[model samples]
Target: MVFLVCLIFCFLAPALEAQVAVRDTVLTVRPGDSLLAIAHRLLRYSTEYTAGELVDRIKRENGLQGDAIQMGQLLDVSLSYAELLDQPVIRGTNFAARGIYITAALAGSRRMLTLADALVAAGGNTVVFDVKDRYGNLGYASSVPLALEIGAGQRAPIAQPAKMLDALHRRNIHVVARLTCFYDARLARQRPDFVPFSREGPGLWSERGKSNWVDPSLPQVQEYLLAIVREVAELGVDEIQLDYVRFPTEGNLADAVFAFDPAVVPKDRIITDFVTEVERVLEPMGVLLSADIFGVAAWGREADRRTIGQHLPDLLPHLDAVSPMLYPSHFEDGFERIDRPVDYPYYFLLQGCQRLQKLATEHDVLVRPWIQSFDYRVTDFDSLYVTEQLHGAEDGGARGWLLWNPASLYEIGFAAIKGFTDSTAATVPVKLRFPKSLGMDLTRPTSVAD
Candidate 1:
């Protein structure tokens, strides 16, 4: 009998351990609290289950017969892998990204390995690759169905995404995928109904004779972008940085039209709602989300914010970080009482970063400004210029900074970072602040009405 019982125990042990591995948390119901609200609040970190599905699980787990729950009742909740990781008790380092942007061409080439080595040697730990270009082409071979149907993945530069990501991850380097939204010329051309209409004529609206922008307020557009985001996140990137997230600004805006009227929905709300939807999708997968906004948007002017559909205040709630293109060269002279803004890279960067930092703090997000690298306007652009910009960003309380050079030529910029490191680099432990999401406050549970 003892031998038979011991043999049977071995089979049961595996099943018991599997059950033990399923994590659960106990929540005390407050006034007006319901099972659905709890599920929605925790849904931000759920990867597999939807809120409604999770509610069913909660009911079955807690042995509740209905959706109703009494105040102060102890309820057992199943926690997802992402939600468990997001618990305040579980902590990890949030890497301060001292980084550079890599074009898809450079990222796919053999030079990528050499560039990674050089960047790591300089104490840089982040690399933002252009996963989707401005022309609406994917940088890698994507399996997303819409991408395949639209031929978006044709001529993909980064043919072997897994191999490239593995090489970077092995070096303890954080990888950020940069995706361009809305201004997808290829996508607009393929789906003519998605393109902006011309108020002046019946044909599609074009910016400077180029019909590159799609209506951002459309549901199909948002779903398509989210699908791309999901594919990239599953590839194990550290973050997703969205660029061109606003409406077109360069050309005949007065004659341009959108699917949604600006009067009823408003432009900022359209952008904000889209970002909120993205956050809902990404947060549950444990991926960081950020947006690149115009540098002038930092001033918080209503006209500038509405025109671009990038009101920082509305967008911050859904982002882990907000990157302002704060390159001083991009600023016009006499804009901020600073003539020859390019000559004052440090001042402009500091000012713009500081302004954004204040707003970021309210939302518990980081401000990682994009610093200039190329000599677009300044004649004296050199290694020192790069170093000064770094100092200014640091002084402005920026968490980190990213260098932007379109051609991926950063020899001078790299030298500046090396010199700057020699003078001021210090080893700091990594830590990720388990921040509050836009969902219901799980930490401080309130009444259901809240």
Candidate 2:
């Protein structure tokens, strides 16, 4: 009988490996434990379901709402990987997502349609629109309770995000919802406890002499952020792009007091944990989760990673892709031996590509970089400059890239697109940056009105 049972199990193993993320264990929720945190501890080795999805499974199995869990509640979870082997990949064009960032205002207005048509003509396949921007405002009406509590819907700039997403979907465009994770001035002002303490006092902290950051460690903060993410995921976005996921370094550094684990843990670890939590929840939903980091990350700065709370190697395990904002202009002069890094666009991103190659291989995460679209600190910048950035990224082995124009004007970028691709019929227009969160639109145009 034993021999027969062993033979049967051996035969079933291969089949099981390809078709199941099965229930392999049961866990009891503990006091103060968020469902995602518990899943993170339990599924450290899981490849099939992210900790967030595991949390979802737990909630479904236990009939819980939101992230709430009673202490000692028994939860059943999956552990099989073979089942996920047949799971469908991200829902979009299988090709690399060559794309651009569309402001909420543009997307919410009539110009969004024009922009979408233009992008399609430019040989672009993806449109990553801002659902929740840097100011902590929602572009769409969010269903999360905390979102409602904080008047996120009231502050929404995009009148109808769902319809807008549907319109893009018809174009077969992969819609990646961008959420400015922590650099939310609105959320900070509303929940002062969430932001780090300013140097001047034991109170709220802000970056750039403004803009408060969300504390990554707080349970409420994590749940609040993830709730919005979940709502957006349900809206059928192909991916959830998380921006500003790091600890601040731009302003008042010495006096900034992190509310959660300020002295107990490293900043990079905190950022990693927060993203890991998001990955855990989003993975089960089968939605792609990406985090945007400072371009300096790819340049290989361990110190910078630690200070900013975005360590590439550490974050790889929990992310589908890591977008290092590799804009050459953001780098200092003499960066990578170039007198002005911005002028030598090809080499600036080339080094980043070569550097990220090893990390991407080691971690198996996609490296989709963000390129410069606006004229920032450059003299006589033109379409050629934009093409250099594109060629640099492609040659450097970046999977894809997104163009960023704070003012929503991509005339220079359009010119580059025209020169690089065979597509000639394109119109370069001046699009005003839309109204946004964080009090004002920092990138709004001086000549145009919203």
Candidate 3:
């Protein structure tokens, strides 16, 4: 019997390695210990499930139909790996995830450690790395069958992702792995059937001089994206952020043919369902999920939401946080009746964050806007300009903010944050606080106007 048990344990070890165990403990019902209290204590920092949900689970586990428990009665309780990992960093009591964006190449290079230090010195504690990009290349080696079969891991940059994650965790830095969905050039090229067909031409439809995007409504595409998320979450990322999760807005959109008819299924539903499915799969793994949207989503325009397949009302409820790329340069002149909107960095971010935060609050989600760090329109773009945007976001009640520079050159941003931290710390303690609890509610307004 001992020999048989040993063989069985060895056989199941590899399979069990991929699964997160439900940590179970037996506890005696003590004086003043209510079921709700116990659930909250077990899942205080957990973003995956609520106290009520856990209460129900506990009742089910012990086969008790009633919430009442007798003193001295023993019960078995469980906590998830996700709950265990959801913790506040040592940087501050209130953990606001002030973060910077890093590309896969930078994340894989030796300079990544130096960049992490620079971020910390700037009073930032989060790093968002693009694990899968528009080109459909995985930054690290992947074992996902579809990714391997399609050569998505051909240019694996971060050879040992686990080691890198361990290094970042040691530094108290939150890691958000960004995966570019839908707009995948590599997947579209190798799997032409997944991409949109051209009504006006013979070839697959693509953004003009740009990449081809997969159809979000397709089950295969959704499963493939979820597979990537599962693989990344398994590698121990703190969060998984989806970029370009929406439908394509550029190119000859009128001439493109998707797998499903937009008139029947509607683009918004397709996008929302995909996000919901991702959340369902990721929540159990103990990792938070987020998505990046066009800055215009904050404006609450129905036409734009329909065009891009990202309705804040539909999307926000499913995400732990929503990152709107609120870059001033991306806005055109005369937006919000302000001429040369790019010139007024503070005004743009303040307005955008105020609108987004209000809507996100209704859905029990966090608003973490992406601020522009690169110079584009403003001639005197410098540290002061970055500082102004940061001020606006904070003033507008954003939980945290991320700096965006495509090339990863953020010296201006670094200086801006450091200056703010130094100046603010002299007067009062400055701490960025991450949300204590996050919940998903499907009962949001159908539209922003509603």
After superposing candidate 3 on the true structure, give the runs of residues whose Cα lies further than 4 Å from its correct spot.
1-95, 209-211, 424-450
| lDDT per residue as tens, model 1, 1-70 | 4323433343233332113223446777879888878876655333322456678888998888898889
Q: List, residue by residue over 215-293, the lDDT tens digit for candidate 2.
A: 7767888888888888788777789999988877777677677665656788888788888888888888888888888
TM-score of each model, in listed order: 0.74, 0.71, 0.74
Question: Please, what is the whole-model Cα lDDT of each candidate in the order they appear?
Answer: 0.77, 0.70, 0.78
lDDT (Cα) of model 2: 0.70
Instruction: Return the lDDT, model 3, position 397.
Output: 78
RMSD of each: 18.7, 16.3, 17.2
- Alpha-carbon runs more than 4 Å astray in model 2: 1-94, 198-200, 261-263, 423-450
- lDDT string, candidate 3, 1-450, tens digits: 432343334334332322443445677777889998777565432222345667888899999899998888887765443213323233332346798999988887667888899999989889999899999999987888989989999778675576567667868899999999999999988998898888887977778955479888889999999899988988889889999999998888898888888888889899999999999998777788889999888888888977889878878899888888989898987665556678767666777777787788888888888988999898788898888788778877788899999999888889988987777511111221111112522122122343
- Highest lDDT: give the candidate number: 3
Worst 10 residues of 2 by lDDT: 427-436
In every candidate, how many clashes are there? 5, 10, 4
